[model samples]
Target: MSLLRILVRVALVALLSMAPLSVAAHEVQPAISDVELSEDTVTITLTTAIEPILAGVDLEGIEDTNDSPLSDRVDALRALPPETLAAELAERWPEIAERITLRAGDTRVTPVLVDVTIPEVGDTEIRRDSTLLLTAPLPDDGSPVTFGWDAELGGLIVRQGDDAQGYNAFLTSGAVTDPMPRTGVAEQNLGDVIVTYVVSGFDHIIPKGLDHILFVLGLFFYSLAWRPLLWQVSAFTVAHTATLALATLGIVQPTMWIVEALIAASIVWVGVENIWSGGRRDIGWGRIAVVFGFGLLHGLGFASVLSEFGLGQYFIASLISFNVGVEIGQLTVIAAAFLLLGLPFGSKPWYRRAVAIPGSLVIAAIASYWVLNRIGWAGDIPYLA
Candidate 1:
């Protein structure tokens, strides 16, 4: 057998071995909630995929819902009709509400289910989200209230209504927002908001962002040399920072569907260029320009995620902090790549043929699958979809 064929077979086998892990990673989406406090009641509208939760799966700590032992149950729940799923949640409200907590002063308040909205059954390949409304009665004394969810429910986006200046923050499991009043809750302090958003931004990149990880790896594989890699990454950072700010400020609004498709396309472009360039030592202005343009598309993608956590007061701080965190994440990736490949073998002649080309091929293949899958053509192909 030819050397290239052998390498291809080895890559395929490695991917197959990691298939279960990949599926699990892709299935988990963080739970997001919008909180509204009024004189009489505190309402939380949570949008999440309820199938795994209903299937007796413990989503806490698991990267993918499928990684749970309750995969069979999750599949069963997915097969259920929207009405049926809603009914099941209604019947299990007591159990479900226990995982979500709302408190007034020192007392834990039990929430009554206001409504449940589930998407109609569609292709099993697409995960459907259900909107849940839970309301808790406020204390007549007008005492401050705290809101949060169990660690098992994942992260929550806590936002306040009734305040002209809007209050919002992203909270991880077990983290509670500052005590909010029935009216006019103060915005979080600038330093605290900056720190909190920095953590949020870092969290999104290190573990949750597989696509972004692959894209960064594509850049690294282009050339492990410091000059070329730094140039590309710098251009990327500037471009993404621009779009992220613009999109968050609501000046440039684009549909997430388009942004996602473009993001995938960007990955393909980087990977293809790596192969075409053959790990050239010199960096070109054209490549830097391309990276900058792709960075804009990726910034839009980042904006989509940040949009879920409404930019409350301290908008500039939050925006800059998030951008700083993303840069940190990118640098971390580059550092790891250097440790693994560049440190020892970067100067070797075979490094380009053995590492850069093969890695780029794999990246290009995965990204091509993403492009097709994003456009809805892959259809139930486990890895591709």
Candidate 2:
């Protein structure tokens, strides 16, 4: 076989492997748990997609539960009646509780399953959330408590109720939060808050966010030349930062469906532009302006993710940290592109034809499909359906 054909075959296999990752990106939803500490009892209300967890699908680092080998079992569980599902969860509570830990001071507190609320069978296409209530008795002395799940359960959004300050955080993989009783203990300093949020933001872009990665790749392929790339990236960063702050502050509230559709459209636009521009160094101001506008849409998309873990006590810290992390992630993508493609072959005569054009075309095609899928035409495609 010709070298080009061999390379194409390998690329096709890689893309197919990444296809599940893309689907999983859109299905990313963290489980939320509301922890309320009362005088006598500690009540934890967790709202999560139960079927996947019950099916032994690892929620952490998984893009989509449907892509799991155990998806068939999850589907069967999803089809069960509410009562039956509740009963199954009841039977499974002991094992599940063992994986989740709650501690009052130095001593472990055992949580008893109080109630389970299962959603009625809805559109099987969408995973439905179920609520689980587990309670543990509070110590008479009223000491501080720490609670977290096993790393295997994935990330959990813990919201603190019954406190005036209302502290909340998105914890991942066995990471526990500061002590819960907010009165005596010191709150997280600004540095701690910043570090936590920064990691969250970077994770969203680097490994977890396939759509965002494609968008960044679209910008990267537009031009490897420093001047144009810097302008476009700076504009995008500034624009998204502005909108991310606004959306997080609740000033600009746009529906996610609209933001997501526009984000996909932005990817398609950039990819198509790269092809049309033909590796030109003279990218116009108009293109930069469009990029900035699309950056605003992308910011709203970022806001949707941040909304999952509401700005707790440290709103400014979290917002700024997350945006900084996103910028870092974006720069990392550009740097990787540079090292991989531009460093070696950017000056080559056939760089445009061999790399730029083909890459942009592929990005455009995938993003166009994403646009259609996000806008509800996914069911029309046989494989996607």
Candidate 3:
């Protein structure tokens, strides 16, 4: 077989390896926890979609519950009535409680389940949140407290103290919070806030934002030439940054479904252009304009995730840091593509035919599936739904 044929087979195998993740369209969101400290007791009210936990879905490094082996169980649990689900959770509380961690200094404390409040099931497609109320006795030595849970429970956002003051942090799976005082938790400094948001942003792209990853890869496969790629990436960065700020500030509000559908379509557009452009290194202004427009859609996607982290008092700093992280992620993707494909094979005479075109076809095919899936056209399909 020829080199192009062998490369094509390798590409197909790689695509097949990613088939498991393609249907994982529904994102597993982070749970929000509010920690209140009293003289002798500490109370935590956590609101999260309890179905995945009840269904035994392993949430560590999982972007969507549908990616779990127990996804069907999660679906069934999601359809349960509020009271029924609450009862199931109560029955499972013994095992679940053991996974919770409430520490005062070096001493671990057991937290008792005080109550659970489950809401009426709305759209089954949308995650239904249930609130878990837990209380634990504080140590008498006046030691600071920390909170965390098993990494399999996924990411968490903790808000300690009142609305005006306290510590706010997004903890990754299996991670612990900084020591929080019993009363009047100090507000996080601006420097710390920047670091936190930046990591969150980068995490979204590297691990969680698979759709965005494919889109960036699509851009990378377009050409090996640096100038054209630079122009397109620069346009994309500027446009998305503007819209991320606008959407986050509530200045521009667009329907989420439309934004998502358009984002998938944008990926399809770029992938198709890579093949149709016929190995042209000089891109026109129209290409840059199209990329800029698509960047606006992608920014809205970022805003949706950042909104979950809640900016608190460091809104401006957090937003800028998050954007910086996103740029870093995009640059990382570009760099990897250059190292793997461009550096080794870019100078080869048949590189476009063997690599770029075949890769673009794969990207286009996957994104076309996403477009159909997002718009509800292919929802009935079993695995790729």
Give the best candidate by lDDT: 3
Task: Put down candidate 3 lDDT per residue, 141-216, tens digits, no spaces.
Answer: 8888889999999889998865334578888768888888887784677888999888888887776676777778
TM-score of each: 0.91, 0.89, 0.83
How many pairs of residues in model 3 come into backbone collision? 0
Question: Candidate 1: lDDT over CA atoms?
Answer: 0.77
Superior by TM-score: candidate 1 or candidate 2: 1
Task: Give lDDT tens digits, candidate 1, residues 189-307.
Answer: 88888887887677677776667777888889898767888898989999999999898878999988778878888988998999998486779999999999999998998888788
Ranking by TM-score: 1, 2, 3
Off by over 4 Å in 1: 1-26, 162-164, 380-385
lDDT for residue 117 in candidate 2, whole number 0-100: 90
lDDT of 1 at 186: 49
Model 1 pairs in collision: 24-64
Error of 3 at 331 (Å): 1.5
Alpha-carbon lDDT, every model? 0.77, 0.79, 0.81
